[model samples]
Target: MKNRNIDFSMVLALTVHDMKNSLGMLLNSLDELRMENENTFDDSSKFNTLQYEAERIHNDLVQLLGIYRLGENNLSAHVEEHFVPDFLSEHLARHTPLLKGLDIECSIVAEDINGFFDADLLTGVLNNTINNAIRYTKTRIRLTANEQDGYLVIGVEDDGEGYPEHMQHSGTLSFKSLDFNTGSTSLGLLFVSAVADLHCEGERTGHIKLHNGGPLGGGVFELWLP
Candidate 1:
């Protein structure tokens, strides 16, 4: 008979999964409360702050789970073709809870193009971007999807201050090379980089890029998928 050994990794993964589920429930509760008092609490900073913090916790747990997956040899992408505009629309819907009013407007532009990506993985990647953008965007956010030089290029742009100079690299910067001096190494960046690394085709792999100035003339996040 084989001995049943306790796997610490599995334990930790389960723990994180539980924490994520609990955080999700909390977010849902907040959503219900906000809906019930939409008019009465319109532009309520307190509710928004609580929701943002809950989302941050949810994202952190997701990234932690992603790190666990990246360390395993079995991690892989579940790719599928999706209509660009529709995909972006659905992604935006997920953040409607957080983007109530505040004079912020969001729109998507895609011209009958389609992109092949792992929906769930990209959702996590976009979750980080949307959360971060909502905090910094002044009045507008734009999402664009198009084909560029044999790759599917998806961009998230905002009309606010752009990325710091240190992060404006051409491609996904290595985690080891990130600015650890300020202890600001973005866990979201690391998670998205790993997800991009898991997707590959014919010597081409997905990658993330940070840049300033797009249609919005502000911070732009581009995810390129081969």
Candidate 2:
């Protein structure tokens, strides 16, 4: 009798790790080329391609790192009070090129939004959601914040194809179930879920939810901090 044994989960994890490293190197090389050869391309296509690839790499790395941390139950989080304007400005500044290349309009809607949360964790969570919106959006994306029911609510909305029914259902069960094969769910949502759960001070815990309708009328990703 012949028996076959395979630890598919371990293999998949290793493969993702290797790809993350490779993607990082590729991004670095592209950055060097962009800097050393500013006038290299006559058209914007090459630059746009580079921007998109870099974003892809960045997204992948975020997912891989998050998954690795989850396996160890050592995904540490630091929550602190941060200004909404500063947070939104920094995120938008980093994606300016990608937004311009895709002709997508980005905006922030809020007067004041101060919250205590892990900067890096929230950044990764919001970045992934916003990046997803950028890809599926028609022409606009927005980051908005509010306070409701003793929780701080931050949302990323897009004017694009609204989430299909199945995906919405997956989101309901858990963000991690967001179908990795599609790449939209990947590690980002899982990481967001972890981060949200980590935002506890006393008996309050933050959480994330996906919705189909909002001002954007497409996808609305909300992170609730309690």
How close to the true structure is residue 202 of candidate 2, measured as C-alpha lDDT? Answer: 79
What lDDT is obtained when candidate 2 is compared to the true structure?
0.75
The true-versus-predicted C-alpha distance at residue 13 of model 1, in Å, is: 2.3
Candidate 1 on 47-77: residue-level lDDT in tens?
7888888998898899889888877755679
Candidate 1 lDDT at 51 equals 85
lDDT of 2 at 105: 92
- Give the Å error, residue 176, model 1: 1.7
Top TM-score: which candidate number? 1
Worst 10 residues of 2 by lDDT: 169-178
Give the alpha carbon lDDT tens digit for every residue of 1-226 in model 2.
6566887777877787788777767766755665566555324676867767677667767767776777767687777789977887798777765676567899999658687888988778777887788778999999888888888888889988887765563222354455768655545667777778777767877787887989878888888887
Reference-based lDDT, each prediction: 0.84, 0.75
Q: For model 2, which pairs clash?
A: 79-117, 80-117
Which residue pairs in candidate 1 collide?
Answer: none
